[model samples]
Target chain A: MAKKSEPQKASPKSLDVSELMRDNDQPNFLNQMQEDFKKMMIDKQVLQKCIETFLDEIIDQLTLGIIFDLHRKFKTKAYCLEVKENEEEADAEQSEELPLSPVKSSPQKCVCPNCAQQVAALRFARHLAKCMGLSNNSRSSRNASRRAATNKEKGASSSSSYSANSDDDNDEDWNPRMNRKKDKSFSPKKKGTPKRSSEPDLAEAINTDTGETDEAKNLRHTRSNSSSPDSLSGSGNITPKKRDKFKKMGKGKERSSASTSLKFD
Target chain B: MSGKPENANGRVSMHLDVNNGLERVTELIETRLIESGWKDRVKLACREAITENNQNVPSVDHLIEVITPKARALVPDAVKRELLHEIEMIFSNIEKGGYTTTLDG
Candidate 1:
């Protein structure tokens, strides 16, 4: 109508204004954009999932600070709980069986009120270290005080209840006065009688087993257990030959064994 | 965030995840759709890069803490500190906001 106004809409083949769709870079740009969009979508989803998991973990950790050892095995996985001191003392008398072994092969039917977990006798020291941060340094200082108390009591009484029970233990308190009794150096061969270092000989025993052959290890292990208080004390005042073997083991255990066995014997 | 085509020629980009606060995760995506069936160079490169990261990252867990602040907080103290310096140098520049390209060339 308007007399071919604006020139009749150009034919499809004869169009000039980019044909409204045939721009050179549009498809390429679009294809790239589409790929990017897909990747971005996947990444965003993964990120969201991660955030959700992280939040869930935080909640679980905070609320469930402690957990129960469902299986009564220690080596694999176990968690200990912190309970009140009063609970410990109150239960002491109730625990009639004593420390070495309890009436139950497993723990009592009590759960740590703070964190619901079953306690184990073997892992109690480790648990105390972790949950309570009770360090070896504290133990050492406490031991020093204990030795001082023993000194005071040793003067007052000839045979205390503590001494009666553990008569075999070579006395750690090497009160310089006892050293004068040279023949009584180690009644059981007066081995290398080192003093009370609470570092468990168990670690040493385990380490020795790791290094040597099976036969050698068995021999060493047997020697460690059999080396009595007498053997240790006497070993401390040993010739160069026994001392060589003593060095291979440890000083403290051997010495304490040698000296105390001789004096007490 | 808007990654303004950092390594377009190399077919990789140091992209920032917008949801995350500018974490410079290296992304290598193919622009051309492999004329039906071609060797995917981009995927190969990505695999190699990820492999490289795997080799280096674990050993450097401890060092990452002093160097890469976020990573340091995540990892434990007992971890070895080998990877810290290299990663720290990378992130420190990104933090400064001037350098965009991963390499000089």
Candidate 2:
């Protein structure tokens, strides 16, 4: 029993020595482990921050690259033309590139179905208006202003200018010649222009206001040598005031030439 | 030029096929891109390409050529990381013999 107690005491002493040794070592080890852990956590956070920043930089660079690439790809010479004032350079370049195709600058030509005359496609509508003798004063004035504006800008094209002059000459010639023929007789000319001669006469009938009904209007139109109701009906909308003006102008037949020329010009 | 890694890649892809993992990854990437507004950004870029030309609308092929490289570069890193992680998971699953059981099931 005494031996067990003595050994128990000795064991306690050994345990105390071991405990003291462990106490000395533990704090240092634990502090080192804590420091290491803290360092690892900080490192992880820093690494994450670095990666995020890198990603952001990469995205920005890519966006910039995309913008530059798109700008380079889509910024074309034609796009600049809208903002540019001068088109002569482009025209000169085009002319140089297609020196063999000088006729490209000229307006296209088509046969006027009514007059059977070759007319510039650009001026074909106006030519048709005069050839059919369905001239509306307001519409013609608007068209003349539009044509003059186009002519000012397109003055560079010689063929278009020449076509414009010829078109004016033909319009004036047709007006005077048709008036002379109608005054002499109601005979239709070889060309289709005089077939429309009764149009002016129908305007005169409407201006005279001899009819209030369609049948009466038809009777008056037929009496004026207009056999076609279709042509009469088409021109029937010419206001009395305009027709009266025409009649007032027609009182002086020789002076009507100058007036008609001035009206068209 | 590769030896073992190429075999590993092939095996990983084969495993992905077994698990229908490739399609899921693709769907995930597409969803991520859409959620991140990357798709809208790309669409805006395409519109800009079309409208910048004054004379005529640019050809589809030309637009694609101009935009494709930048679009590829613009994919978010998070999506790329998730995709790479998914691939790693596929590889690990293959290594763990999960491929056989999944194929069997």
RMSD values, in order shown: 29.8, 24.8
- lDDT by residue for model 2 (B74-99), tens: 67777867655554544455445533
How much does candidate 2 score in TM-score? 0.25
Q: Can you write out model 1's per-residue Cα lDDT over A123-236, one digit (the tens) per residue?
A: 555544433324565433434454455556554565557555234223443322233354256564333233323223543554355444455544555577565432333333
Q: In model 1, where do residues sit more than 4 Å from their true spots? A: A1-3, A7-265, B1-105
Per-prediction TM-score, please? 0.13, 0.25
With candidate 2 superimposed using the best TM-score fit, by how many Å does residue B89's alpha carbon deviate from the native? 1.9
Docking level for model 1: incorrect
- In model 2 chain A, the worst 10-residue window by lDDT is A12-21
Of the candidates shown, which would achieve the greatest TM-score relative to the real structure? Answer: 2
lDDT of 2 by residue, A48-105 (tens): 4433333333344445454555455455544345435357778878878896575577
| Candidate 2 colliding pairs | none
